[model samples]
Target chain A: MSRHRTTRQRGSSANMLMTASASAGDDHSDSAQDPLPSWNEGATKQAIIDFVADVTREDSPHFEPRDRRIAVFDNDGTLWVEQPMYAQMDFALEELRKVLPLHPEWRDRQPFKAAIEADFETLLKEGARNLQILVGALYAGTTPDQFDRLAAEWLAAAVHPRFERRYTELVYQPMREVMAYFRANGFKTFIVTGGGAEFVRAFAEQTYDAPPEEVIGSGIITRFESRDGRADLYRFADVDFVDEGPGKPVGIESHIGRRPIAAFGNSDGDLEMLEYTTGASGRRLGLIVRHTDAAREYAYDKGSPVGHLERALEGASSNGWIIADMRRDWRVIFPFDGA
Target chain B: MSRHRTTRQRGSSANMLMTASASAGDDHSDSAQDPLPSWNEGATKQAIIDFVADVTREDSPHFEPRDRRIAVFDNDGTLWVEQPMYAQMDFALEELRKVLPLHPEWRDRQPFKAAIEADFETLLKEGARNLQILVGALYAGTTPDQFDRLAAEWLAAAVHPRFERRYTELVYQPMREVMAYFRANGFKTFIVTGGGAEFVRAFAEQTYDAPPEEVIGSGIITRFESRDGRADLYRFADVDFVDEGPGKPVGIESHIGRRPIAAFGNSDGDLEMLEYTTGASGRRLGLIVRHTDAAREYAYDKGSPVGHLERALEGASSNGWIIADMRRDWRVIFPFDGA
Candidate 1:
């Protein structure tokens, strides 16, 4: 539920029925031989292929043992649509709506009042602070298990307004292929997100092929209590750590205990993570997913309310970061767009 | 350096020169055939063997998938020796000695002076509070990599006084065998310690065959800062979270994000971890190593200054936790005691 805000409007809706043939016509393809079939043949795709080959090849000077092959990816805009708002933000807003009846005091409060009435104008005026207040109140007293259940239930029934499909179904096909490709090469792919860890954990395994432990993100403080001879953890409203911007490096060190060889992100929130990752000695990769295809997916960068990508985009060339232009590099966006 | 204070004195020193020939005469010999050859034929060994078989057997009602077969072990006494003091406490004390000259004001400080002078009586009188002050100061501003180097260097040069062996060599051979057995059966073994995570991670991979990510423990707050275009994390004096007693379950949840099917420990610090692990539905195992072999290892369990084993020991029977008596259950205490 945490994001910056701007006045940019949502772009064109994705053509869900559009076949892979549409993108294929304008993009080069070696779908028959490529491990990343969803990716068109381009410098961006070649960078990914060549990096994997270098680290995994036994005789190569850049060869890294399997255990050291760690790769991290930012969630929101990089893996899925974050144009209208962050998916977690939408989930939090809906949660606020559901709980508004119980707390009438929320009807008069600034953030709560705007949020309860679905006033995007007032909410966007002060997004981060308002969203933090709402999310903190919404998730405060729930246990991790309770939060997981809520997230799972919400994700199951909730549909993205633009796509008219389940949020889980809106994950990028090419990113999923990239994750699978990394895993197949013995690289441990971890989803390092700015979203709540528990929220992402609910569907990370099924949606992203990442296990619960592999997903690191922002977290609420959790207290361990013994209740009726049973051990339980209660998530508190206080923020434990935020796994965004500079926190990405701290979270990676705390959770993974190793520097990732490759990092992928879509915004300035991931700038520090990419810097830490690709800055390490030896062959490394830093990739930025640029949402340039407005026809297939929403597009916004510097001025976008959510996932504003100005500084990282500008520094990509200097940092040796690959910027994957969605319109040019990807053969398909969502899985429904491909065979 | 965090531990309970007790008035009990150190137990008998281990006979490092005592060969396998001595114990082999008294213990059963099926070394070539047994997976856990260091474990004697007993109810404790059988309990571990049976639990692994039941979960791995496809026909068994208790069968669990490979990914769910998680086994966690407490580090201090369960995996290695914590006799005269906890090994981490010893490391902390040694670090204090090296840094004493740099902090002249510490010469007059109660805890610092007492620790520097090797005044065990005063240090042990108010152990937890005094040790906390010393440890907090010692590890305050160092980066994780710096801390790792300090711990690694100390561990390499440090030797256990009684056994005249390096602290790493003092690890329990029986416990090592059990870890190997679990891994061989597709179980991921993790060390859920009450000690500093960075301290354990320095040697975990080499000494215990546990990767850094698998060693969950207490941690200091870390901050990420960018210096010279490089991201670095600096450890703060403030304690982030302690992975002991009630915090064990909390740490396990934060790090592994799954319930361990099997839990192993040797003290009250692991009481809640054992409770949580064994309390879960389905096939579960909880085993505690009772340091009853004074001649082979150290044995002052119930009233020991470190690794106190009272509440957990008393509740073991009612909780269906297996108590592995070190004297009777282990054929060899350390790897040096056996082939």
Candidate 2:
């Protein structure tokens, strides 16, 4: 029951990506031209292009001044598939299992043991914090470089259970084009998420072209220590900052030192970010990605365990935030799945 | 007794900036041709060019792959004068006096009384936290927009006592040129300072061409709230993150998400950032501004009150960090004052 549903959502999952590939290979060399081919040229797509054009045009009243054209995107749901489980949570669970041989003590720990043994019911009973704990374990004492390498290796190999493609590949092609579109128009794109900052940073450049500094998210503490006459920063097993809900705006002010001109997010966790971003004085944009595609990707919104979307779904229209219906707005759900 | 001295140090304070204006008005065409005209042709200047050229060249083995090219700089002495107290501290002190009428209670408060009365000895006795407390007052209840306005206005009018020029004008012409040089060569320049992040961010784009997002510095805690349907973030009187000494590296990682390929600093606070940046794998560059121009700019190193530079002075040559001698190497000490 999306507010907008059309032929864009009619295609089956099997030919989704292949269809996109065929179009992408044909004369899409110009950076500014054909930026959103994965998009079905609907009102949503037109709105984004029009906004960017207004801001970048020299004579336009909506022209974003120097140091003001910041674009922020939420990870997990907005940019990629975050159904059944968040890809990051899935990663953390896998990492916990891999280290079971070294952490025998984890076998006796409740959350760790449940996670290691794949006890989904007990893990679910423990609630969302179980994911944080697993993430902490994933960090532990690994040097930042080591962590990056580990994440890269895992992302390259790990495949989604349902889609049978790497989680990295599940990032929506339409959204990816949107990011590039922003970049081409002089907006600096940043990833503001509740997921681990370092974890997202590991593959942000490769997956989204957003390098480390451009990616802001939840992160644990880090301490600098010199060993063998060389300095290495070690990750601590404690939360330093969280980038969800209200924290998203705080994170933006703290790290980037400016209010973003536009923001993209999904779920209640992103509501505050959407409000904060679009609420700014000048012309601003706030977009919520409503996951409504079941054939191409998992679809769930209100009351779902992962990436619950009740608040945003209700507030999007009233807030004048554009609702990106995954099934209706996007031509393709994932990189591998075409329209 | 000084380590390096030349005719550049002989000029009295009055003529420092006058000499710089003569060359600045000249046609300095070409990005690479006259990058750092304020810098006397020396090994320090050449080292910077060589490192940038090698890393930026696609064919070179030392070429940085992807978009990992980052350059970080400490603001205080590295980019601007830290002598006669930091510019940010001075702003906080001024704000304290201006607000004394509203908060008459500050007249009895220990540190606040000292700051309002211009009791430098008493303020110094109260230590660094005194400045932070005053800064919290400067930020208290003021929205981000209001804060930006106040900071911008203050910087526009605030004049350096000795130079008799706006504080914004005190930024090093040589360093500014270097930042432009970096930008010209596809490098993103960032001001990684121990100064208040918001304070520095207010003028960073105007003075350094480093946008607000590109500026990283120390910060206090902030809370998000909405009033009159307008959401604004409030600064709290508590430590959030410090960007000094070892904290610089952590700040860099947290904000930028990667190690910088090049870093510039002055004094002991920047030693860790210097080590962190230069110590990264592949070709790297680290340069420390040595304040030795006594007549043109206030000179202090190793044991002076502010910006003491002892450990870094000893480690510079050994660590292969270039020492930019203010007296001998800089043709101009400030934008107004030339060698």
Candidate 3:
């Protein structure tokens, strides 16, 4: 039998007692018994176990449907490599180079000029407004379907310069296991991110096993109408809504209609989501995946220009949010060869 | 057995199934086996049936847990009476008269002046914006808990002008039956409305049996923090977000991560929510409650001064949305005096 099926069989038999007394240690031999063997034993692991235990115990006050145990995760740093620069920015820059011939004016525009010239510092100084402009320019005048196809194509071929691996392949294996583990336990996993909704949704299913509809993110305004005697929806660059920080909770509240019992993030961007999730009455779990291993992966946190983890760390302990120490809590980082 | 249980047992085991297959020409007696005999056999009945069918059919593609089947309803025209002005508006006007002594400037304000003189025509012309201003002014400066208590007190004694019954008792019997039916089938019912979230939450459980967190609505922003060595979250009059029109979908998308397969609305404000819900790829349903019987309830659509249904009616047939024809479909409207 396959390893996962064997684990499922053992889980059904051994873990069917519906009690809260399951050992909190990582001593269980996971060879064919636990599918999540790579997770480390600590606050992060304990939080997951305790929350799931309380929710699964029929006698516990917090017991809820295994189906209602939805967990939403921020994608950028939490799921895959977002350091150096956002992986999507790299893709946009490459696409810009390819499309430069068509848009000759971009060679002279300030930020666009800097982008074409490969000046990363100038781009950073421009901040959020510039980023919005870049996103609008990259995604404008394209149908959502076409944009998805382009995004999928870019993700398949794009490689991280530092790791020299395809961007899709750089996804953290431990996090992937977490998604699978949650699904195994009857939790509906969703990707709620600040990235373009259409952009991430295009490849989320193929990469994370999360379907397109389950993905929620920032979106451009779109209009539905008939074109050429067939129904068609046209996407425009006009700002629709931004899904970040407090907006994350707002987005989740608007789209899902049910508050998630669990949330995961890696930086300050996800602080609001974790706050909202943990603030919910009853058993809740909030986790932050801290990139603290520079050797295996990148390690800068509070001082890092990208995915800064300052305010989140300040409130982590007090708020009871688990900060996953990459070097200690994760047995593996990226699924890179020889890692 | 209880009356409902006895009636259910007396009918054929396939009573509900037979009712489902019966043509629209069948009278209310066809549903004699239905546990909720108080419900009328129009759009409200169809909505309940569609939702229950989708959630209960394990073999059907739309099958889902009863717990996930959340049904939200607007209060005024949907659950109660909006004719001769909204009941809440009357309460607000009364409260304005009582609070006018504190704020002397209100005696000269246009809308408040009209309100003081019972000039409802002027108030209606001022529209929703004026109502929002009044709510902000009245609801401000008080703690959220205090406001909730005040609302509860008002709800306890407030009476509908036309019905001569407690405002809470103005709820439609057919809709109430729908609520019970949904609950029996395992659906988590909610009240997504433009009413104050905390205000409606205070009395929703007592009136409609819907729990506090399940009620989403418009309200002032509040801060969750400690104050002067005591823990207190205070509500402020700052308009946070309006739960109407496009905001309904935005609110649903943010709070609930999963898209509802079904939705119900009575006005143009609910149009976006119905659109969003029905836009989902799978088997989805949307229903518009058309108030068409002036004797049982106020019949107004298209150009009605209150809760206009022009846009909704125009698109209902094309969108495949069920239009609840109150005159032809319902056997009763309100629960009080066996209406």
Candidate 4:
């Protein structure tokens, strides 16, 4: 059996010693004294503090190097707005419109038919499998370079319908700050979600400063070949791997090789990742963003349609996962607001 | 098509640089450096000098942050001896003896039968395919933690048959210096090879200062499960990906994202990786270790049973690859001899 380090006291803040000082321009500088400045003093804030303190203090014996401090996050609700439908679904619908003339048969296909006809409710009913079909049709049979260029173009112009902001700007400001904070502290941050890895990787570096290599999401199969005396990696129509539920930890192990010291999620889909992280040997932290503010954001957990949060909420307390009360814990929801 | 950078001209004192540098180290260091240090003043040294200088110069137009300058290396012939047979083959042979009692049927199997009878010639005739079976038998069905421990034990004690020294000690000292130099310059170095990723990863950190996350190699199938209420990654008998040739570029793209500005290799297997690196639209360098010395290091290429060099040699001149002439370049070959 792998050696398991003893867990530290649950709420102890004594072990929070700073390792490398944050460089200038750190997002946390505005509220460095509080450590959890942007977060309200609550269960979520306390859990973060306790975990960080334990892992950072060398004297406490839980200290790990900055390199080993990997932290993975789910994108949709945890990082940005997921309500009204996934942003990628919107892009897929638009793409289908543009490509329909070339592939007239797609107009009659089940999911593609729903997508091309703008029957989003029907598309939603078709669920994840339909989404996979849409992604495979849109992304496959192109070189990775070509796919990247296409994704970048889509992200540049695609605006959220409800927010009327570029999809890039729709990212949650608090989560963005959290990412920056983790990075500044030497944590190798990664985005592991059910979203298409290639799609997210195209703009992730520009939007989050997390490079494509660090993003582990659902992936399509790729083949290598030389075309015109140059090597190209071409995406195939088949799904190679999916990053959801049990697949989350599998993806992490396969790609990153290290168990994350911390994990952040918003729904039950991420519960497995949280379980894996918190159940790891050393100091561990798991945070669940509870969307509880209807005025600023959609507020529903067990009843939410987009990112259903049932098991995650029910097990948060017992599993020592911090369920962030979105209405209270977050001072700001999106970057545009001056909270 | 991907942009390709022109190969930089070698420094005027390229030959002097390697020779002079070789004499500066201890006896073992000199021995290691002598094999390749005095190489004829040519494109190889120039590539090394130009790339190093550009990366080191803060004022250089092509300068990158030291931290972003990552370099990956293949282990076997690139770092140490791969003659007689691959190093892992030696380990497998020893493991066969240990596991023979448990698998009595091996005595009747063709390749295993020969292996049990100490018929090394028959094992060689069965060739690469036979080795694969041996590797799977020796490495499969163990927990990652268990494999790590076993690998560590073998690495610590296993010695090269001809050299009669620990396999770890056979690593070229000049390469060791390169690793340190890269680290000192703030580059995060990694090992990406066709060899078993986990096997190399188990000892790379202790021997090369490359942490587990930084090491990327051919991966085995792994499963994530709760064992005794603790999560662990279990190694399975299946191969996940073979990180060789074109797979090198794919692996790097998937794992590191950014193209490495510099790359080093010893054989044709690394040609695709070097091509990928030098093809990036920036200052880049590619160096190949040509085993030209039969007296000191048993040098043979093309028809050689180990690490053949056919297409790589043909492409070296046109592709602007620096071929390290082992016989002329270095004053010594191993770390044990004085410069």
Q: Which candidate leads in TM-score?
A: 1
- Fraction of native contacts (fnat) of each candidate: 0.33, 0.44, 0.01, 0.21
Q: Give the TM-score of chain A in candidate 3.
A: 0.83
What ordering of candidates by DockQ runs from best to worst? Answer: 2, 1, 4, 3
Error of 3 at A304 (Å): 2.5
Q: After superposition, how far is residue A174 of candidate 3 from its true place, in Å?
A: 3.9
DockQ of each: 0.23, 0.29, 0.06, 0.21
What lDDT score belongs to each candidate, Candidate 1 first? Answer: 0.77, 0.75, 0.66, 0.69
Q: Model 3 in CAPRI terms: which quality? A: incorrect
Chain B TM-score of candidate number 3: 0.82
Model 2 accuracy (lDDT, Cα): 0.75
Candidate 2 lDDT for residue A314: 87
Candidate 2 residues lying further than 4 Å off, grouped into runs, are: A1-34, A101-130, B1-32, B57-61, B101-130
- Please write out the lDDT profile of model 1 over residues B207-274, one tens digit for every residue: 77666777888777788886665667888877777788888888888777778999999888889899
Docking class of 4: incorrect
Candidate 1, residues A163-192: lDDT per residue as tens digits?
999888888888877776675566777899
- Most accurate candidate by lDDT: 1
Classify candidate 2 by CAPRI docking class: acceptable
Candidate 4: which stretches are off by over 4 Å? A1-32, A107-133, A302-305, B1-43, B54-70, B104-137, B182-188, B226-231, B332-339
Error of 3 at A41 (Å): 2.6
Instruction: Tell how far residue B38 is off in model 3, in angstroms.
Output: 5.0
| Model 3 lDDT tens row, B1-339 | 000000001112112211232212112322445644555655556665765676667787877653246566776677777777776677788888888899999889866787788776676563444565677778876666577778878888887777778877777766666655654454555677866666677666566655454577775655534457433345555666677766666555434433566777888877777776676576666778889888877888766656767786787887878877778766666664352
